[model samples]
Target: MRYSWLALICIAQLSFAQKKQITLEDIWVKNTFRPKVVPGFNAMSDGKVYTQIDKEGDRQVLRVYDLKTGKQERTVFDNGEHTLEGKQLSLDDYSFSKDEKKILIRNEGQPVYRRSALYRSYVYDMSTGKVLQIDTAKVLHATFSPDGSKVAFVSANNLYYKDLKTGETVAVTTDGVVNKVINGNCDWVYEEEFEFTRAFDWSPDSRYLAFYRFDESQVPQYILPMYTGLYPYNYVYKYPKAGEPNSVVQIKVYDVKDARTVTANVGTETDQYIPRIKWTKDASKLCIFRLNRLQNNLDLLLADATSGNSSVIYNEQNPYYIDIDDNLAFLPDNRSLVLHSERSGYNHLYRWDWKSKRLTALTGGNYDVEQIVGIDEKRNLVFYTAAEKTPVERKLYSVNFEGKNRRTLTPEEGTHGITPIEGFNYFLDRHSTLTMPSVYTLRDNKGKVVRTLEDNAALKGKMWEYDLGNISLRQLEVGDNKTLNAWVITPPNFNDQKKYPVLMFQYSGPGSQEVGDRFPVRDFFWHQMLAEKGYIIVCADGTGTGFRGQEFKKKTYLQLGKYESDDQIAVATYLGTLPYVDKSRIGIWGWSYGGFMSSTCLFKGNDVFKMAIAVAPVSNWRYYDNIYTERYMRTPQENEKGYDENAPEKMADRLKGKFLLVHGTADDNVHFQNAVMLTDALIKANKEFDGEYYPNRHHGITGGNARFHLYKKMTDFVLTNL
Candidate 1:
């Protein structure tokens, strides 16, 4: 009996010893920690069916499924059955027209920037099995007209239309020239900062099209050299730095029936920004969002399509800056509009009567509303997601338009992303927590689960092979009696008597949050790998981050990195007081804006952080774009001291510990000039630091093996320096 018990004990010991530890290769090269997710879905207009792309053997096919039964209804488009240009059609993406009679199939797209792409588009008729290519040249932002009788797209910075009935193409504007004039699309800075690429809107009646015309001849040019061969090639484009000249913008309305264009009289100031141009429900009226250079005042103007005259319907002023969002929902009545406003100190919904020009609050609380999921005008209900439970979590809620009968739809914990169908009858809720991966389920409007779509059982089972440390969501008190949201990942098999080195990661940008209640993304997996190496990874959302309140987020207004860096220093100091922390071995690292923060922390707070790794960081605010920089810090001309005081380039001499700077030479968003200038400053200060540059890589530093190589380098740096 004793021999039998010993045999069972030996078997258990062998099983425990076989479990593996996370490695850098497991994260970057092997991709063993990747999770399965659902593909993009398009809810049909019927409010009962949805469409998604699927792979069938060696071909891609579009399949429609019923929402109620969660079963496939039909195969809409089969690449094996269709042919384009004498070859079998292989669709990369597709979109349906309003009438659902035609599908726009996209293939072989070339990316221009992060959000802009040019693609070869083919219009496939559903009624007849016929496919027609719109243009021989690649086009940007291609879409069918509201009536599905024509297609509009941007080619070579100009707007062009093709009449499906006549098979003829017409140019709406002929003045589009590279770097001099741009029509139907936004400029580089606007596209990068304003978060949109398509700059044209089609009226609901299909008789008028509204677009933007930008004159960028006066803007300065920035060039990036590409070394593909022995000879270097220069790619030059117009880029406006802080306190520099912006493009002269003009809004124009084109009438399809008359072939006439009228310039909108937005305001007398030609230098003002026209961030958004949308068509109202009424075909004759167009809505425009105008902001001053300072971005403190915002005006909503209604313009006539024919007359080209505009009147301000709504005006708002913020002490600091106003934010633009996708919350301007117009009801079917055409008399009222729902606006997302921060007037209540938190982002909430407000109803505006166009005739009376009066606003009424719809949702009011201490927390902030994250998004407007759907609006059921027939039922007079507004469904939304809000951070009511905690700043790190988002929950779904439903309320009346009049701010009555508010009800929480999601009751359980975690971050809930709700996607409602057309009629608000059903929705898809995706929930994820720190310990659990995403689980997708179909639920009714009242939050009753009907069926499970994806449970990620494979990923959850595979995760048991590796050691996942304890991840805790906690708060750290900082200056001004405020608490910052933080997530800490401890090493598995932690010993209370032993001290461990710490590594901090943060993206302390405006209206951004990193410490959220979602499942482990790529960053979390990276942190887990570090934790397995006996390092505690700390991620904190400091001041100036979003999802709190307006005051908490905008406290770092004119002084961009001043308070944020101070909070990081404070966090490091507080962590030093813990029993299991190595105070002298604390390090920090980040990318982009977080990179900027790391450089600043290593310089100004050199006593707190022993090392820092900055990737694609902005050394000075003056080197950044006008819209994003000027919004927070005003122009360098106006706030010269604020721009210079917190700049890492100005404080390079204060570095005391190890530092590593990394950048991509072809990064257009935050130019490589930032790294060059910082290097020059460091050399002048007699500072010794490490540097790495990726050739022909963009801001993301991702291509074939580039990303994997970069992360491996970072892992080595952390291992040695810290």
Candidate 2:
């Protein structure tokens, strides 16, 4: 009711604030706002789900619910302590153990590279109602074993294991070489690309541990500066750039019982990345997903724990590269593996028999398998979400071994996800789109609605009060090959004949889809403010953009920005045809990878786009992490042209439009070096761009007065530039 009252007051304020009288119909709608994505999800292995919820008065609670009943079960966690501990507890992130016995809580985390610090961790034992710290020193990469009897963690590039029973800690690898040596974890390259943090695994019996070791002494180390500011922070980081040598990575196994260590070599030198490693059901064979430096070849090697003998059990190769995702699901039996591949031009699932070494294509179609949700081993059915409904929309479905009996489980759809519970018999779903907030529901295996969960319509009703200018969603078909799919947002009141200036946005990551039919974020607010002032906003999925199938998304394989930038220029050029778009006034922006694309556009497409904003982008691959950069462009050693020709720093001389660059001084992902390098290049080339340096903020730009100030700065930049 108070929100409703506030809306009424805002409407009254709008009456006086408007420069001229306007109607709701005159308002424009665009994909300008960027609503927060569901901040990561956590599922307790016991089939309960916990989601962060906001109450009436800004009280944030981590509410636990029975997935089957859709009933609020308990408050597992919360902000502002209400319990006896009295000390305030907030989570940067958290993970549950296999037995649902322990929770590795992340708190007071600091930024490392692209991700954050492991910092202080509290291992809360649920059964005993006891909370224990991992160590006196803030640890990094603290994780639990399969049996949950001990917790394994990394501190200062070295690995340690904690005994839950005895509360004893032992250093697993004393030779934790830094800059030159790393133990039980990956170097910068592997963390950014392969999406891994800890380079360790536990056996089924929990008696043995498998980990990765890095020798980066030979790898070139690029340097960046740290600054003191309001938060007053200074630090140094060792980074590698495109064409730089990456740490030589190796896999090793440690027998906890015997204190014995054995290095496992796949008997090959091409083991540049160990993306994933899991113990087999037998606890003697370790399954490792290894890829070449180029990332075009993927090998599933089975390493014997005792002898370290390795044999390739499976292999996949693609010209563009195989993505390192949670695509390969090892069934509990360990005899079979469910693999998702884009070999057939579509992301489809296949079942591989490890013992027989035979492959069986399970799901084949033009649509991509968004996720493998549930699988019934006894029934031999695979439950998954697919884009078959619509490229922008997703629905949960189930299919069998023979690809028979494909059934959709949801009628109300937008961007939906499921938490299958009690071994796939039931599920809890949270779904929403741009036009709506999320609604949670409970459903059964037969696709029948079992219970009502939550409908976020109230949030939408509350939003109706704002004097949001006219917003419209439009499609743009533009790219290098004239093959691009894009979406645009127009400010509230808009007229086609007025030729409003355009501001463009995009993520443009390898496997990320930014222009999906999802809730918009604060960018929408900026767009609304822009629309109120007469501007159009646009974003597109250029080549190398995700979920469109292999050929379409992989076109930018070697040269990361070539097609993406061209597509952005094309989109802006096509906007010139809209009669409402002022082609010469079009500007662009994005964060991280998006920032890379935005910078690339301002330089390569200078003739079309007038200005650009890049936040925390990689100016060169050599300065980025190895696992990610090598995947798309291979090593700079192998594809110097790909890394060199299109880098923002390399193309700094071509800048023609206004440019504003923003980055967190502590950004770990893309690194602040990206912006510094580009700035240096711009200076060397006598090119000028607006820049802002956020002190002590991480990749997400979160801190006091940080996010709000960032939005304010971006709003000012877009308004002034376009």
Candidate 3:
């Protein structure tokens, strides 16, 4: 019996030793922990099929698949079979015309900004099976007209359109000079803040093309130096900082047939912003969203495409700045539109009858609506996702136009990202919980699962081979009856009797949530690796985070970092009281806005955090863009206290922790100047800190081995400092 017991113990030890240990290479370099994702597909207009790009051996093929059967129905375009200028074409992205007779194919795309890209484009005709090159050079926003008779694109900041029948190209604007006038494209600030790149839209009848012209000559320019050769070259671009001058924007309508352009009446104020311009169902009328410099008031104007006349159809004002989104959709009635607003203290949907100027709420609750998925006009229902169950989870719901017959389409407990098909008969639900990998499913409109798509079964099986720790959700009560939503990842083989060092991570940006019940891919695996090394990981969504309510999200208004940092400090203080946490070894880290928070928490809560790592942080808001900064803190001239009080650079003297600052030199959004200024302040204050800068890298700090190196450095810093 003793000999048998010894053998059993040896077998158990062997089994335990077989488990794999996760490394930084597996997470970043090899992408070993990456989950399988559903391929991007566009639902066909027929609603019976969808088209997706698939790889066939070494060739790229655009194939149509049956929506119900998930079987390939037909091949629309095969790059291997087709050649452009005797060279094989590579597919990047594509879109079909309104009639589905022609396709606009984008190949060899070059990214310009976060949301903008230039592509070598081609128009493929289904009937003729021939490809026509839209432009010899890479073009921006190549789009097909509704009638499939013409294609419009932007090249070198100028807008031009080509007639498919006549094969003739016409320039709509000739005075489009780079860095001076940009035709049919958004300026830097508008594209970054408003979240759109294509500044032109085709009318329903394809008779008019409304485009935005930005004269950015007066806007201040920022120079980014590239150190590639012996003599570095400076790349200068218009970047309007807080209190700086903005581009003079004008909305113009182009008569495609007449070849005449007329400027719309958007008021005489050049300081105001035309954030959005969309054509209503009535091609003659265009919808324009105009906001003042402060962005507190939003006016929806309906402009006549012919006469260049306009009238304000809807106007909304808020004490705080209003957030603009792609939620305003015109109904087929031509007189009604659906839009989201925070007028009821929570983001919800409202149907506005512009003809009568009457507004009716379509959705209302204590929880916030995350997005308006789509409207099923045939069924008179609006599909939307909301945080009704909890702020951490998103579930899809559908309601009628009159706010009746409300039903939950996604009743699951986790996050259900709904992508509705064109006819609203079916939707693709990408569902996942904190503990489970995402499972993509095809569901009918009634919420019945038609079929299970990719479920990341391989990842689930692989996860069992690793010693991933337990992740638990918690609500930590700070002061004043306020509680923060947080997630705690305990180390593998955790013991309640033993104390463990804690590392807190947060991105406390306004309307941002770090703690959620959804499956995280990159950082989640990294955190697991840390947990394997016996470090407990914690992340909290504090005040100013979204989905709680308007009051909670907007609580940090006018003081961007003050209340958010306070909440983090409070949460850290609460964690310190726990018996399992080592109060003396607590550390914090974050990126971007979260970086700002981590730096502030280290300085303001100097007694709580022993170390901090801030990556691509904004040290001061005044150096940031005007639209985003002024919306929250106002201009530095108007609210200097708000801009300077919580700035990390201003509080460099209070740093008492082991701080590591990392930034990319070519970060256009945040700018490398923020890091230089903060470093100067730290030096002036006689503060000791570690810093790393990546040459020519953007805000993401990625490309080649940069991300892997970044993680390695951060890992070493945390291991050494904490």
Clashing pairs in model 1, backbone N/Cα/C closer than 3 A: none
After best superposition, candidate 3 residue 571: deviation in angstroms?
0.9
What's the residue-level lDDT of 211 in candidate 2?
Answer: 90
* Leading candidate by lDDT: 3
TM-score winner, 1 or 2 = 1
In candidate 2, which residue ranges exceed 4 Å CA deviation? 1-65, 68-107, 122-133, 229-234, 469-473, 479-483, 620-622, 671-673, 680-688, 695-699
Tens-digit lDDT string for candidate 2 (286-398): 98888877788889998988778888888899877888777666676767788798889999999889788788887777878898886787788888888886567778888
Supply candidate 1's per-residue lDDT for 270: 79
The TM-score values for the models, in the order shown, are: 0.98, 0.85, 0.98
Task: Score residue 272 of candidate 3 by CA lDDT.
Answer: 91
Per-residue alpha-carbon lDDT of candidate 1 for residues 618-687, written as tens digits (9 for 90 to 100): 9999999999999999999889999999999999999999999999999999999999999999999999
Worst 10 residues of 1 by lDDT: 520-529
Against the hidden true structure, what lDDT does model 1 obtain? 0.90
What are the per-residue Cα lDDT tens digits for candidate 3 across 1-722?
99999999999888777888899999887888789987867898877799888998989889898888899899998889888778878878889999999989898889888899999999989899899999899999999999999999999999999999989989999999989999999888898999999999999999999999999999999999987899989988999999999999999999998989999999988999999999998889999999999999999999999989999999999999899998888999989999999999999999999889889999888989999899998999999999998999999999998889999988989899989898999999999998999999999999999888799999998888998999988998886789889999999889999999999999989898888889982299888999999999999898899999889999898899999999889888888999999999999999999899999999999999999999999999989999999998888998999999999999999999999999999999999999999999999999999999999999999888999999999999999998
